[model samples]
Structure formats: C-alpha cells, structure tokens
Target: MIPDHNNRDAAATPPDALRVVPVEPSLHRALLRLRVRPAQRDRVGSMADLLADVTQCPGSEPMAIMRGDAPIGYYRIDASARSVAGRDFAQPARGLRSLFVDADWQGRGLGARAVALLLEDLAVRHPATRLLVLTVDCDNRAATRIYQRAGFVDGGARYHGGRCGPQQLLLRALP
Candidate 1:
C-alpha cells in the first residue's frame, strides 16, 4: 500500500489508510463498479472503456484509489508523452487520465488525498517521470481547484483534444 505522507497527521494514521494500487485481476470487478456523479459522467467516462484503453495503450497503467479494501476511484498513468501534451512537453512525462472518486465517496477530501498519494507512488514506480500532465474540463472548477491545490499548474492554454469539449492543461513536476 502507498502511504499518504502529505497529511499533517500522517504518522498518526495507518500508512495504508488511502492509496493507489494497480488494478489487479482480483480487484477488477470491484474497480469497474466505481462511478462518478451524473454530471461528471462525460468528464471521466466509464471504467470499462478506460480499462480497455489501458490494454491497448502500451505503458499505460490502470490503477484503483482504495480506501482500505474497497475501490473508491480510478485513474491511469500513460507514459507516452505525446498522448497528453502533444508538442508542449519535451521531456519524460506521464499523463494522468480518468481520475475520479466514486459519487458515493465524494466531498470527503479523498480526491485530493488520492492525487497526493499518486504523486508519491509515481516517484517510486516511474523514477524517470519528471513531469505529470493532465487536462481538466474548463467548467469543472471543483476538480481544477483540487488539482491546483495539489500543485498542478495551469499552463494558460486550452487543450481541445478531449471529446467533452475544451479542457485546461495542467502540469506538475514530480519529485
């Protein structure tokens, strides 16, 4: 399990209280059941579709954001630099895709915590990844704020590659 060291009381909390782990065969079914709010359906898309995508895209890792033994969210790390930044990034980077907490588990600070855990996990899993890039829907202020608070910076340019319309391009340098 990945630890949530960003928390002030991280030492007080169990190391595995929240984390991101690869979607193993045993957790596939439960991970597929995770869903976002109705309004967010278009932003993140379905887990089945995203899972299938990871299989087709080489170096893409499908992961689950877990709280104890249950999956509360899901996301993918794409090692292909062109898959996300196009010509924006010129160095080794990873793309953060399909990140969302289950609707039932939202509004409890889990999303932010999950992102923090993901950054920590990436440092160990992909030591070569220096930059983390992602596109957040421009209208999704809540998610934008969360990403910003977690240290993702807006590049001030909109990425029009998303099916849900234009998205704000955000980047973060991984430690």
Candidate 2:
C-alpha cells in the first residue's frame, strides 16, 4: 500500500483508505469509469482520452489513486511548457489536468487524499517547480471547498459558454 503521509484525519479518510500510485496504461480503461456523477460520464470519458494522450506524450507523467489493486481516481502532472487557464506557467510546474473519484467513494476524503498525494509527489520530484494549478467548474462548490482547504487560491475564471458553467482557475504555490 502507498503510504498515507498527507496527515488525513480518520473522519476524512477515504473508504478503504485508497493509496495513490503511479498510473499504468493498462488501468486507463478502469480509471475512466471513476466519476462522482452520472451526468459527467461523457466528460470523464473525454478526460480519459486526454490522459491517455498525455501518458503517451513525451515529458508528461500521470498518477492514480488506488485501493489494493483497483483504480479509484487519477490525475496528470504536466512538466512541459504549456498554458492552462490563460496563464503561462513555467516548465517543471505541475498542472492537475484531471481528477475524479468514484461516485461510491465520494464524501470520504478520497479526492482530497488523492490531490494531497499528487502535490506531495510533485514537491519531492520537482522541487524547483513554482506552481500547481487546476480548474474547477464554478458550480462545483464541494470541489472548490476542498481546493480551498488544500491551499489552492482562486487565480481567475473562464467562461465556457452555455449552461456548462464557468471554469475557475485555482493554484497552489510551491516553495
């Protein structure tokens, strides 16, 4: 099992205490199925496709949260020079491209734990990286709260048109 070094309280512990691990392509299909809401099924699938592409792309590495041998969620950490949320963060900086916990695993702190694990890994492996960024749907209050508690600050917002809701950019600066 991967070590839980994030200081996660037991009350906030994820069901089964999922351990975050390096994601493998073989688990991609399974990780794609993990989502908190049925309405987001298509979006989640698209995210999986993006993740697969990133995993194959040079200079990118992905990680997943797992329980025993089952994938519960996944996130990609990009080290390449790219702009997210209209801001050009430097290379070696990390961006949380996608993160989703299984519906059955919601409200147990699994999402928070997964993010904490990713940030911890980034801090060690890429100490010089200055920023960690992510985008959230404006309507996703729960996720916003989690991010806020995790030290992410609101950086900016982007309109995606229609009722899909605006996207809010959040960031956590690394020392």
State the lDDT of candidate 1 residue by residue for 1-175, as single tens digits: 3433334454565644887778887888898898888888888888888888888999898888887668899989988756876754767788888899999999999999989989988888898888999889888899999999999998777988777888988999876
As for candidate 2, its clashing pairs are: none
lDDT on C-alpha atoms for all candidate structures: 0.83, 0.70
Instruction: Give candidate 1's whole-model lDDT.
Output: 0.83
Evaluated against the true structure, the overall lDDT of model 2 is 0.70
For all predicted structures, in order, the TM-scores are 0.88, 0.76
Clashes of each: 0, 0
lDDT of 1 at 141: 92
